[model samples]
Target: MAARFRMKRKGVGEMLRMPGMEAEMLRRAEVIKGVAIGLSPVDENGPHPGHYKASWETSSTRRGGRKRDRAVGYVRNTAYYARWVEYGTEKVHAHHVLLRAAQIGGRNQ
Candidate 1:
């Protein structure tokens, strides 16, 4: 057949793809993590007693369940007081390192 189907779209199939997109994304993730950690307030005991720095961690893993092929960088903080530090507790001051880092550092990515 000369025309198998109706074509109402352009060439999305030939769109340019960045070869280092995956790697760049991962690198950006790590950069954001570093900025967060750096911005976190440090204490005599350790980094961010508020849990901002204490629990902050970075890891590499897959994005989904075989849905994608590129590995990604993951950063997180699991400290119990982490939230208290970020949002602030009744007596503590609100230290917005996580938010600030993502905003500022993410720009570098």
Candidate 2:
């Protein structure tokens, strides 16, 4: 008697659209969002103290045809000054809050 082996060919695109994949992406996005909020600088002396931190949010999307072939997670700050805080101007130092959060979240996952 000989042992038999079989493999199903689903491909990467189909694998991404799986229900579990979207769930995982959303979970990771939440993690990343939390980390970003923690890392965000709080300007207590400024008028809008903690505004940047409070702006942290997470969203997930599927991209492709009608079936939607890709799952993507996003962590973003809605504050108008978000870019300035993350990248910084000549007068201010770059915090790289979101960048650090993503790095931390990726390693955690």
Candidate 3:
């Protein structure tokens, strides 16, 4: 007597499109955005005040079809000085807020 077995693959495209996938990705992105905003520096007395913190935004996207199916999350600060605040300038030290937030947020998922 012999046993026969076969493995069937349903593919990942369908799974990528599954009910909560997009929402979950968006949620994670939001988490990252929140963390980034919290870690961002606030110039209380500066001309922009809370502009940097207020610029934090979140976005999510699904792409690459079945073979490379994946969800991407983005947390961005639209402030003109975002780079200066993050990477710092001549007299400032890099804050690395987004980097820290992404590390923390990625661990959350």
In order, what lDDT does every prediction score? 0.66, 0.86, 0.81
Model 1: how far is 87 from its true place, Å?
0.9
Q: Write the per-residue lDDT of candidate 2 for residues 1-109, one digit (tens) a residue.
A: 9999665556777787777777889899999888888788898899999899999888777663456668877788999999999999999999999999999988988
Residue-pair clash count for candidate 3: 0
Q: Taking the tens digit of each residue's C-alpha lDDT, what string does model 3 give over 66-109? A: 45566656678899989988899999999998989989988987
Decoy 2 TM-score against native: 0.84
lDDT of 1 by residue, 9-86 (tens): 333222212344445656777788889888887676865455556567766544422544445566677877778768
Superposition error at 109 for model 3 (Å): 3.6
Better of 2 and 3 by lDDT: 2
User: Higher-TM-score candidate among 1 and 3?
Assistant: 3
Q: How accurate is candidate 2 locally (lDDT)?
A: 0.86
Predicted structure 1: clash tally = 0
Off by over 4 Å in 1: 1-22, 45-54, 60-73
Task: Show model 2 residue runs off by greater than 4 Å.
Answer: 1-10, 64-68
Our model 2 lands, by Cα RMSD against the true structure, at 3.3
Model 1 Cα displacement at 38 (Å)? 1.2
